[model samples]
Target: MKKCCVLIPYYNAGDTLLSAINSIDYDYLHPDVIIVDDGSQITKAADVLKEYIGPLNIILLEMDSNKGIEHALNYGLSLHGRDYELVARLDCGDLCKNNRFSKQVKFLDENPDCYLVGSWVDFTDMDGRKLYTVEHPSDFESIKKLMFINTTFTHPTVIFRSNILDSVGFYPTDTPAAEDYAYFFKIIKKHKASNIKESLVNCTIDPHGISTIKRKRQIKSRILVIAHNFSINKYAVYGIIRSALLLYTPRGFTVFLKTFFNPNR
Candidate 1:
C-alpha cells in the first residue's frame, strides 16, 4: 500500500475542527493526520480536538504566533522525508467524502506521470447544507481552461506528489491569498496535472471566512495571478483586465460571465 498523509492548517476553527477530521473516513485508506494550529485565539479549538483522540497518528503542532497558511503548510511538509508518495491537503472547516483518500491514492498509483490530482466538490453553507456542486476538468487541455478562471477545486480536495514540492518549492509565502493558485500554475506549467472528475469533498462556504470577507486579499491575489503565471505582455494585459472586472462583480456573476465568454466553457 502507498503511504499517504493529510495535512490540515487550522486557525480559530473551534468546534469545526473535529467535524473536519471526522469527515474523512480513514478506514478505507489509513493515512496519518497532521494538524498545525496557526495561532488560533480560541482555546476551545485545542480542547475540542482532544475528544477524538485515539490510536490514529493525529499529531498536533501548535504555533505561538500566526504564521499564515503557507508557513503552516511548509511546517507540516517538513515533518516527513520522501517515504510518503502523496500528501493530501485538508482545511479546518471543510469535509472530505468517505472515499476521498482511497480514491485519490488509487488515482496517483495508476497515473504515475501526474504530479497533482484534485476532485470535484460540493459547496455547502455554514449549516452543512449543500448549495450546489462544482464540476472540474479531468484532462490537460481542460485543465488549462482553469487559467482563465478558478472553478471549484477547493484547496482541501487536492492531493499532490511529494517530489513535486522539490521542483515547485513550497507555496509562495509572499502571496498568501492566492498561494494555491500560484502553486498550481507552476505545477501545470512544469509538470503534468489533472482532476479526478469525482465529487470527493464538501467545501464549506463560511460567510465570515477570510476568502469571502477580505476584499483586499482578493485584489492582491489577482495581481499575483498575473505576475506569476502570465509573463507575456498580451496575456498579462488580458488577465489584468479580466481580473479587474471580476473584482467588481459578485462571485456567482463572475462565474457565469466566465462560463459564457470562456471558449472552453
Candidate 2:
C-alpha cells in the first residue's frame, strides 16, 4: 500500500462518487482509500462502489445516523489511521487532475516542514462547464496572510501531513458549514501550509444551498472563527471586518463577482 490515504465522505452521491474515484491517478500511487457513509439511504456506499474495478483496497464505514460530514470525517480519521504519512480529502462529484496526488506527496516529502498543501481548483458545474478558477497563494507567507480573510485550501484539493491530526485532532464540530475554515485555522496556527500555484482539482459546486439562510449560517460561523482567532497582525483585524461584511453581503452578489472572474463563460 502507498503511504497516502484518500478519504471521501459520502451522502447519496450515486455515480458521482465513481467519477471522483476514477479521477485518482493510480499510475502515480494507488493509495489506501476510506469512504465514510453519512447515513445514506438511497445510495449505499457498498452498492455505489461495487462496480469499481481498481485495486480492491477500499474500506467503507457507515454511520448509523445522519450525523453530517464533520462527524463522518472524524469517524473516518479516527478509524483509518493505519500508518499513513499523508491524508488527502476528496468529495463526491469532484475530479482530481492526473498529477494531483503525486504532486502533493512530492511536495510534502521535499518540504518536510510543511504539514499541509492544497492546489488551485477549477470550479465547474455538473455539465463540466467551467465556473471559475480558485488560485490561492503558493507560498507559506502569503497563505498565512490570506487565512485571516478566508480558507485558502478548498477541501477536496487539500493533502495534509497525517501527524497534524495527532497534533491538532479532528475538525471542529461547532463551526457548522464553516467547519473546514476553523479546522484549517487550528492547524495553520501551528504548522506551515501552502498551495500549489497550478490547478490540480476540478471542484464541482452545487447551487442547491447557495440561498440566504445557508449563506448566513456559514458566514456567521466564519465570523466566529475569525473573532476568536488569535493574531497580532493587522491582517487578523481586517479579516474580522471582512467576515463581518460578508455576513451582510448577499450570496448572489458574491456569486456574480466570482462568475465575472471566470475566464471561461
lDDT of each: 0.76, 0.85
lDDT of 1 by residue, 1-265 (tens): 3488888888888867788888877787677788888887856356767788654578787888888888888888786625477888988779888588888888888989888889988777778876666778888877765564553256889999989878888887777677787778878878887778878988887767767776458666857776666655554577677777767767656444544564432
- Model 2 scores a TM of 0.93
| lDDT value for model 2 | 0.85
Q: What number of backbone clashes does candidate 1 have, counting pairs of residues 3 or more apart or in separate chains?
A: 0
Error of 2 at 118 (Å): 0.4
Q: For model 2, where is the 10-residue window of minimal lDDT?
A: 205-214
How much is the lDDT of residue 26 in candidate 2?
83
Stretches of model 1 off by over 4 angstroms after superposition: 53-55, 81-83, 231-238, 250-265
